[model samples]
Target: MSLSYENYLALEKYIESFEDKRGSLIIILHKAQEIFGYIPEEVQEFIGECIDLPKEKISEIVNFYSFFSTEPKGKYEIMVCLGVKCKKKGGYAILKDLEQELQIKDGEVTKDGTFRLKSVNCLGACGSAPVVVIGSTLITEADTEKIKKILHEFEK
Candidate 1:
């Protein structure tokens, strides 16, 4: 679902707060995701309009970033790390356990709208290689039991 023009305009005002020298695009995109729940193509276009950049340029930025998602996400999105370090550290096993428990594949949302499972490259937490990020919160060294507890919290 897309926000109305008025709401998008309001988001523009909100995005302005994130404009600074350091990684402004990523910050704005995060804010947009906070507002819209997902970074759809329209949101990218709106971001471009707000930042006075072309849609193509914004699309490029979106494509370049693995953190940004163009599709709708569940209320609690579960991001599993599958980077080299993470994979070698049992991250994939944790993800497999979660997929079996949730009965959903990677990149798919459950029918109940509680969770969406996604495999991400890295969380920059190589020390905590088997990391699972629920929404914006990171859970390092998460096992199946820990993941279950986390999902229970979201269900409530």
Candidate 2:
């Protein structure tokens, strides 16, 4: 499938709003990701065409940031923190439990495509160690049971 008509319109308008800006590449990438859910290769090509930049350059920007997802993510992307603080607070245990429950390796989406699990360096919420962010919601003080409950929320 292709991007919907409304998404195309939004892309055009967003591009125009930042046509001549000096340091707005990161912002542009965010807007693109919001419009397309994830920054697929084809959307990167369209962004390059709209801004008159090379596709590889757009690819570089996407690769430069960990926040941007290159492929299509599931309905829920669980971001578990693996920073120093988190590791000290059993983050690895939480991650291992999630891996087994979801039956998929880290960074891989489940078979039903309802959830995708990924690990990040830090969410800057060290005080709330062992944190996991589901979509835009952050869950701190997490453990195996907490993670299992959170994952159930994404279930039908």
User: Number of backbone collisions per candidate, in order?
Assistant: 0, 0
Q: Which 10 consecutive residues of model 2 have the lowest summed lDDT?
A: 18-27
- Where does model 2 exceed 4 Å of error? 1-37, 42-54, 61-68
Q: Quick one: best lDDT, which candidate? A: 2
Q: Across residues 79-134, which tens digit of lDDT does each residue of candidate 2 receive?
A: 88999999999998888888999998889888887888999899999999989998
Off by over 4 Å in 1: 1-69
Decoy 2 TM-score against native = 0.63
TM-score (all chains, Cα) for each model: 0.59, 0.63
Q: What value does the lDDT take at residue 129 in candidate 1?
A: 71
lDDT of each: 0.83, 0.84
